[model samples]
Target chain A: MSTQSTRLAARFMVAPSVIVLFIWMIVPLAMTAYFSFRLYRLLSPDRSGWVGFNNYVWFFNSPDFWLALTNTLLLVGGVLIITVILGVLIALLLDQPVKGQGVLRILVIAPFFVMPPVAASIWENLFMHPQNGLFAAIARGFGAQPILFLESYPMPSVIAIVAWEWLPFATLILLTAMQSLSSEQLEAAEMDGASALSRFRYIILPHLTRAITVVILIQTIFLLGIFGEIYTTTQGGPGSASTTLPYMIFKQAIVAKDIGRAAAGGIIAVILANIVAYFLMRSIGKHLDA
Target chain B: MARAASPRRRLLTTLAAWFVALLIFFPVLWMILTSFKTEASAVASPPELLGASWTLENYVEVWSRSDYPRFFWNSVVISVGSTLLGLAIAIPSAWAMAFVPGKRTKDLLMWMLSTKMMPAVAVMIPIYLLFQQLGLFDTKIGLILALMLMNLPIIIWMLYTYFKEIPGEILEAARMDGAGMWSEIAYVLTPMALPGIASTMLLNIILAWNEAFWTIVLTTTKAAPLSAFIASFSAPQGLFYAKLSAASAMAIMPILILGWFSQKQLVRGLTFGAVK
Candidate 1:
């Protein structure tokens, strides 16, 4: 029943976003690919030339690259384990008929709203600082030495901060899924002599499977590029102990002024992200048809 | 579902819940509390919970002594400007997809979402070099456009999901009344879509305001937002607990309040409406 003009109008309406996003995706991506093969250092422009595969070979063979790869995996894996486990427990608790639910919910979700720099500063200064930090105070009260958390356990410290930022996200999604579970099914299970643990494991956990997958897949995408936390807290140091892929790229481009190498690393980051995004798109695609 | 448990059990559950909530919220609560304390007391050994000589000096110092207000203004302009710009672009696109039912609309949307999945670092060198060439580096206009592009996909996805819920029959009714396209959208669609628009705006604003990556990376002193401003303190000065708390609290409090209101939309918008 729709006429030609309506269809034309729809095309006109959608054009700006499509065009803007198209350029946004393709132009930078093309430039990155182009630069990866060129010897373009911001500092030494006179030295510029086509480097071919040298940049990628150098980036892949660097010690920092391996350290960053391991650290990135550890950071992503660590935060996922922490957030998902704690998120499930927290979500289950929030789903209970507890008083002050509104305040409790706000309290739990507050960390997610915090900017990364602020969150890093808070933990780095207020709680994780070896001298005046609260953890130090507690250690002293127990007649023990205060550990230099960032120095001694840089990856774990970074993981903790990032996990704090994302815990609420996982909890919120899982809790939403938890609330949608039909009570009648749980009641029937209870009547069949299933214990509380069995009911949760058999009933609630299975119901939350999709939500859990969403949380893991989505969080993995964000966590894979963890930069601000590392930048503000460790600067990917005492050495390359905490340098993830994004931070490594940042150091390469902004600090070292090595555009060619950073572009190479950037392309690698894209490939790594696309793998996770492939699964994420599939899951979201499933929802589209339903 | 509302069947009463024993009083003891209920009390225990409440206690457990509150305890865990506080434990999770402790860092934020401590930051807010420390913001009121004198610098010396802020780092007091065997840290005082409430016994510290509370003062408003840190807030005053953070606000007045440094260029705090300038960074705050930059954050405001960038987040709000980008969101408004994104809304202008997204509303029409989302509206068309929701109403027009073109064969490729789903693919288009998925593609838009895929753009978001491209890691920001993937194009860092290009964007940085482009910004330098275009004189957009370390400027408010530059930051605004970057954040806007960063968030445009979410804005479209959220609006598309919202607009999809408004029945086609309503539009058909408007058409039968002889309203033209512009008039139908102006008179009928805008009013119905306002709430959804507002929710999307709020959520995107929070996202833009708290966005740390581009804001920190792309700007120096002139255009640095609070995120970058706070990142400056990562060195020795960050050890000033009271002042750091004050600055951190000021940077996050507004979005925290906004976030509580938009928690529902957060799930829907972030997961691309898959969970909901």
Candidate 2:
């Protein structure tokens, strides 16, 4: 099927996308790498100097660095746990011969389509608000004290919002994967008097491994940059309690005008991401026949 | 045939699943219901379910007070424009890689997918600085280009997976005929691959539409999509509950409908086609 002209044309055809992505990756990355070494503060626009990793030193030495790193990891880890666990349960339920499956599935996937800002604000004002939120209302109705969600439990609250947004994504993906499972296998085990738990353990769990891995990896990529929801809801507030790495970088660069420091933080994030990406790239590429 | 569940089990499953689904979807549902309430009733304790007098006043006020249409228009142009542009570049690129095998093809595909893993914040400074320097900041064209670049890999990956599944024999058969390259693609590939292409386009548009990070950071006013519009509520405002709900509902309604319709492709798109 591969002719000489077609082969040449293949290289030619793939060039534009490749070149654009290369520039997208390399140029800003190079600038970020270069600037991370130089002391470039936005406040004093002309005071650029060769800092020789001073920015990295300062970024690491700063208290927010480690705090933000922990928060970042926890946010990713927390949301991944909540969403993937609940997503699996929901997918399993949806995979059953339930009534109104179409409507139920639509309701399930609705949250994934809502923009982050809307989701956060809806939570902030309507669900998580201390005085007047739905939770507060529910608490008051039960003759209990209304809890301050974002104020007292900032990290968990932020995790909740982000998990809500991503739960739909995991469920949608996992549900599709579950739908693709061969029903005959499950029925075969059932015919042999295998208990439901045993069937799930032996067949369903094994089949869902790939989808689960894909969910974790892909969600990890987006979860590492949990910014908008935090920005809108917590603003990484209550003394930087919910300040994830991305928000920390944003604050350093935009709010503090510390470009070099932010660039260093950016570098740190890139290294961390590539660490995750390394495994992901290997897995996805591991199975291809060509 | 598979044995059917007992009626009682089906009822129990339906009840349990619906309860959980509704619980998960409650925030969005509550927002929609709240949007129809007056300012006073919206924040009412015990959370009026159907007790409040329904009114369109909030929607009317939101539409008149804010530039809702402008944000809506920008969201449309950015999502739709970026998607179409992505399709143009991706279709050919995916075609080349899928039909013509190279030793590095899988490596290249993996590399491209890895691009999606790069956190946007990692390159925030340079892109921000460059956009400011080129006067591309806070403009629709700037956003369109940034988002298009941002989502290029997904576009290519989705199209590649879709194209790869078309069975190479079909294209080979087309080649065996007297058809030239142009017709081979235009007639043979286009007609057959249109559904996959359309689904890819749909999922990409949804992603771009809901994209918050770049949309919020890159543009301040002129190019601010619904993301920024909704983010404006973060600042403390007086008695904005109903209006906030109204705006939130408006922001989510279109994509919610679109997402519900094209969910299958979204699964394939997000999983790098591994799941489907």
Candidate 3:
């Protein structure tokens, strides 16, 4: 058989799954676009009328939208910064020949496997509770009033929790990258009388650029849609202080039952995600090809 | 290359690392401890780390109050079912892309992955509406289907990465030997890529098991997984610290055990191509 025909046959074999995914992606997206243009609300059936760009106008005009956007950015940025910094430090530590390395590694990665809801609930009930939490107990031991992590500093608390979960992931990636570093290059630098800082800055950091970028990109993708932690922890509470885009969309759709506004929020989210994803994909795609 | 650090420096660094590890793990550890405490003891000031009269009463109460066994079984079935179904579909798709040269293959893969980036809330309304129309709401089959679809992209991506690592000549050799497609995949490819497939399955099962939003939104009592089971404990009441902790611990222990056992595979799967 010709190569072209063989390729065609392979395509045929792969078509069903691809087509299903395509429909799944396109249909909901198209519906969101349609709803974004229409004036539709769940509460009023008669409000289903053609009102192009009205939902977007309201969303763009609303202070809540800007607040949610800022919160989303803060959450994503804070998580990335915390996870990458701590991940590198932890990876460097674990890379050393330490006792009980296997156990330490397991302990480090354990948080990533815990379900988001479970993690959030554990934090809410056991670790961050104002009166009875571990932190509160520690505060009380020092004769301090218990401070609420979620109520007073909801976004930061959520960011910290998310960073905690993702740090292990970043560490695992960075550690794997660290392990694959060529010893010859390091030895060469050392023989040339390079200091540890210089070696790391010049060689190690460059070697890690791709891995770190991958970590940032992938984590950003997941972090943008972070819902469970925020929901379980704060429920976007204390007067919408912690409501990110995903939470906003959820509120519009599930709580308010306004399909149109929720759909608009959904479209905006897609656009925002695509913008980030496009750049990340381009960089990672080029790196993979190379 | 070998400047030995001082003992003090080594100890400080090691201590710091352990402290951070312990800090990150404190919540889970605390939850386990809290699960054993009475409600009042759970909320005690200067919390008793060891002096709290330890009891399994909370566990017995939570276990008897909720249908935990049923939820556990539902979680197992949905997670395993979705993972297996996703693998069944993904293996072939990934195999085709990895082995065949096509102009759109990369684009197609990216598109599928992009679908994952679209937040679930974006499509929640339509999905809810569709499920209601189709009478799929609150059904295990519905959840299994949703999870399989939700996780299909990651499965294919992981499988594609794994399949790409195998040389094409091996599969070509099987083809030349008159082994059909089924035998080629089942007899040759499956065994060669078993590790990757295993990791993918493990990761998917974890994801499905932990999935909360859809499980909570879609299913109520009958088919809700541990995620929903845990969420149900969160009430408007002022506090239910011990019960919540108990529920959280129960929900997490099984997956936590699974995670502990498969830590290596989880790490490798997560960092699949990041290192290279």
Candidate 4:
């Protein structure tokens, strides 16, 4: 019964959270929109002018913008490809009846919980350092020069670190989805003389398609906002060699003090994220029936 | 599917799985191992695995050299404070949306989730400037508020999913017995949703603790959490592998253990209830 009093109480209950989040969303968003048009530099506070579209023009014209865009796409796409593929395979491996399954899971999923900065520094210094790092030592042991990971190969190295951090997450989610698949279907297929490959092709692959999509969308959202790993390792440098979109905005605002340019880049990032999020929400929002 | 396999096959698969698991876990394992080594041994080329002498000096130094305790305290306060704050704001809203009739409830929830989609950097400049104007930059309260708001949508959505599962008849019965809103939640909903609330709190703390981007940006020394504290190690000090590992292990150990406990909720909460 939706009585007047109950409805009133419900409205009251929901208002505080809604109001706060609404303000949080609209305020900064409006400010970003406002600042995108105005030239506001942090250093030169006296210089404020309404130069419409100039900031966006300058932001687009910058060479670093294109470089960061390519790196962003590469990071997201590279991490997505590696994680989803390994996630499926590892999910399959973990789904098998192995001894010490719980221990194996703890080991595999541990990296996802490592804070990004810690993970990156661990990679950068402990493993990827030019001379003293473990990878270097391994290369020396193999009678070859250690490949400078963050220096000569920043993109791939960052991709590897980010992928290492995420592979566990993808594996965990895909494993959950895999476990939900009814084993009876597999048993029946086996009884019908189906080979392991055929059973997997017909049953497991179809079952995993939804989980795969979920992994891609969720990981894409996160991969879009990656900052800590890049920040700690390369600081988006060796000259914008490893710059992601988020780090670039931070650099522009905090380092360069180019608020107008930073705001424009931020708007561009929001549009890119919303594009992926729109597809993500549409596809996965349907599954969230509680 | 559950049939017994040959002993050899079982052993082989077990070996293979453990190898892969350890390979994946090597970085963390190596960090922990390195934390015990001397600085020289830490950087020694053919990197020391077991031959290096172990000592508690690195841990002791890491604790003594910097304001580790302050960062630790800040992390605890921000993570726990934000979780509690998010729960306070989310519970009533989630309860109302879950139990009450409203045509726009679904849309409202989606809108909330979409807010989470807005990349944090997009609002970076505005929030950064606003924090300065509001004098919230690099304060514990400021970080608590930002993280609470950042995580509120997920908290509300998760609690909403939990609240939706509780049969309405129970709450309705409470209302029939003259329990008002406060008593109803205090007595009925609280007890019923305790597990979900607990898991939600755990997940939120883990997230807030690991949050690096904003924590790094907003604060330098005063309000820096373990994230920023460890990030400081990323500078020249990162060359000191043992101390860096020591600081990192200390920073991540608590969340790592908590994360292990919430692995199930990690999937459900992170995917926004899409998979589970």
Candidate 5:
């Protein structure tokens, strides 16, 4: 199995994927690093020159940077808390001996399939619009003034929409993990006079810890760079209320056209993501060995 | 625990589960219902759910007035094209890793998974510059390549997990019969792994379809997929509720169907096989 010729062929086979991924990861990253040290604005390309650490300084110094960082943390934290808690509950519920389980699973998992922009717009316009949205209509039905959801609470509004989109994913994964738990274990515990609450706390919750961690890490990787939901719903607005790190960098690059500073911000994003990836890879690596 | 429950308890659980599912599904349901209403009736006071006058006018208008078909076609091309490209590259690699173990295989897999953790915005500036410089801005090919790379890790991880379940002895047996490598893969391995390959393709397609960041950033009009096309409706405009609903429904319906089919595979795919 470890012959020379077979190993040669295996290397040849694996080369393309490895090589392409290497270039995909390294090349743009190098370019981002290169441009980050130089002063280059998209609007005025002729006045370009290297300015060591200036872009980083400018990007880090901005109050918007801190705001964006806080917003990013809040967005990730909020979505994780919501999705994990609700995901566990819904998954536990769905795992019950319910009638029409297939249809119920389908209904619960539908939101994860909707495209982000569609999800955002549907919520923003149809559900959150103050004047004519469904919520407005419901409020008016009770003779109460309609609350302008995005206007008043942009971060929460975006979080709720994102949570809706991601709740299905968490539920699906947790449910899969739940199904793997042996029913005999719970029954045995019941015979030992364990109450339902204690059974959940000891048996069910412990069983789901790995699945919950997987959900959080995977969701955080995607959530840190959430763009479409904010872009479609709030536009990072009522004056940067919902702007996360990625959206802030996006605005710097696309809207502000300051290539150098944007590239610096891009590097910052890479560093931040790598920190999370370090922990995620560790967990997955342990799982791999197990 | 499958304990014999009373009828009332069984009925209670069923009702509770159904209630949560419907509550979660209500927004999509509302969107679909809104699509059939007249523009005026779509925003009617107190919101008519069932009483609104249903019509096909919004669908007709969305089809005719906007570039809906082009966007839909663009979505189809990019998602399918990227997923196919990803599979082509991933299959050989996954095959190698699964059958031919090497000292670095685990490291290689972890490294590949680490690449997925690189936030897209980190390279957005450079990629955007490169795309503009190469005259690939707003082109489907550019997006196809970008998205292929973005999702390449998941594709490889999913295919690898699937391929691992395939017995290496079969390939060794084929080798013992003097079958060539390509023949073994083409004839023996391909048939055995077809179901896994198909599921990988399905999950990849669904991911590519709903991919928002790169699709929206890279393409403007000509290559704008349904994701970007739907994003265009963010601007406030009068009398667009029905049209927006129609467009949103069309964008999500196909993938929603595909996603439902691929739910089992999705947990593995997205989690990099960290979760079963």
Candidate 6:
């Protein structure tokens, strides 16, 4: 067969998967957009009639909506702050010529491999248990009151747990970018009496900007849908302190069985995530094309 | 001129780095240590690290009380099954996109990736309703399909990147020699890209294994994976600390071992194309 025919065959082979992805992406999202304007609760299916924009109004009018939106922003912002700073620091540390570097790298990445539910459970049970947790025990030994991490500061606690999971990813990506820096440049800086801080700030940070963008983009995609950690850790509990958009959506749809309101909430969450993702994609697209 | 000061600073930096690494690893170590302690010792006031009498009772009780083997097998089936199915679909698609470039190839790839950016919960209700309607709510196959679809984009993206690294001339050479498309991809392209393919498969398996949302929501008792198994111990009233740790250990051990062995490949795969 000629190359043209072979290419045609390849295209034919690829079409099905592409179509599947397209339908998978479009249908549910269209349903979500449609339901956002309707009045359809799962429990009250018979009484459900068209109440256009009422669901969205009801959702936006609720104080819980604003609270959940704020929580989502805080969760995303807080986790990003913690992960990026620690990621760069750890990336710099791991980049040095040190013994057992491989093991240390593994130790750092191990948390990322851990299932979120299991990680959250471990943090809650083994690390954050007020009675038997390591932190509690250490606190008592130091003559301090045992701090209930999730209970007292639900959002920050969730943020910390998630940061632990995501920091390695940022570190790995940034470290790869760091290793690509030409050693000659660093050597030149050193010969010119450039201090460590100067070299890092002037040379290293500039080199890592693209990698940082990629890390932030990728991590935001995952963080926007962060359900397991919040569910397993706080269940959005202690009076909905840790309930982010995704958690709120889950509770509205699954627990409350208010499908229309949940659908509206889902649409809002998608809009919020996409707004963040749009900027991220632009940066990533520039980096990829460059 | 500054060698003496540089050496001292280097030593201090190395010490600080090790300290931070230890701090990050401390929780996992603590969990493992707590697993070996008795319930009383695990929760002891002083939090004895090395002084507690080690016991295997937690592991034994955890194993006996739950069908751990079933959960383990479920996890293996779902993760491995999804990964294999994903690769089976992704390889051909990636091969086509990488070699047979068309006007819309990049657009198609980007479109596929954009699907991943949508929050899973946005579709959660519809999927749940569909699963219930189709009678697939609590089955291994349901979980497998969900995970496969979830990870397919990443698999295809990684494979596309890997496939792009291979020179197109190599496949052209095979085609010129009268080899068919199947032979060109199966016998030539695949063997050359085996390492990349292997790493992609490994990473996808880990992702599928670690997935918690759909697994927890979709499965109940029969097809619940280790994530669900560990979560069952989180009772509001129960204080099963030792057993919880043991269950956690059991849940994490497989992936932990996998991560330990494949850390190099994982790091490389995750950072693929980022530096370049």
Which candidate comes out best when scored by DockQ?
A: 5
Write one digit per residue (lDDT tens) for candidate 1, span A1-290: 56899899999999999998877778999999999999999898899899889999998899999999899889888998999999999998888889999999999999999999999988998999998889999999999999999999999999999999999999999999998998889888888999999998999888888888888877887888777788788999988888998999999999999999999999999988887677666766464443
Q: Give per-model CA RMSD.
A: 1.5, 1.8, 2.4, 1.6, 1.5, 2.3
For model 6, residues B31-110, the per-residue Cα lDDT tens digits are 78878888878778787777897999999888887688799899999999999988988888988888888888888888
- Candidate 2's DockQ: 0.73
Docking class of 3: medium
Indicate the docking level reached by candidate 2. medium
Between the candidate structures 4 and 6, which one is better when assessed by TM-score? 4
For model 4, residues B80-140, the per-residue Cα lDDT tens digits are 9999999999988998998885999999998898888898998888888888889999999
**Who is ahead in lDDT, 2 or 5?**
5
Candidate 6's residue-wise lDDT over A1-290, tens digit each?
A: 23688678888868767776766667878887777777778888888777888888988999888888999889888988989998999988888776577778777777887788878887887778787777888898899999989899899889989988888788878887888888888888989999999999999999998888878777888888888898888999888888999999899988898888898888888888788887777657776662
* Residue A196 displacement (Å), model 2: 1.9
Name the runs in model 5 displaced over 4 angstroms.
A279-290, B235-238
Candidate 3: residue B27 Cα off by (Å) = 1.5
> Which scores better on DockQ, 1 or 4?
1
Instruction: Provide interface RMSD per model, one decimal.
Output: 1.4, 1.7, 2.5, 1.4, 1.3, 3.0
What is each candidate's DockQ, to 2 decimals? 0.76, 0.73, 0.56, 0.74, 0.80, 0.54
- Clash tally, candidates in order: 0, 0, 0, 0, 0, 0
**Mind sharing the TM-score for model 6?**
0.95
Residue A137 in candidate 1, Cα distance off native in Å:
0.7
* Candidate 3 lDDT, A95-205, residue by residue in tens: 765556677777788888888888887777677778667788888888888889999999888888888889988998888788888777888888999998998899888
lDDT of 2: 0.88
Q: Select the stronger candidate by lDDT from 2 and 4.
A: 4
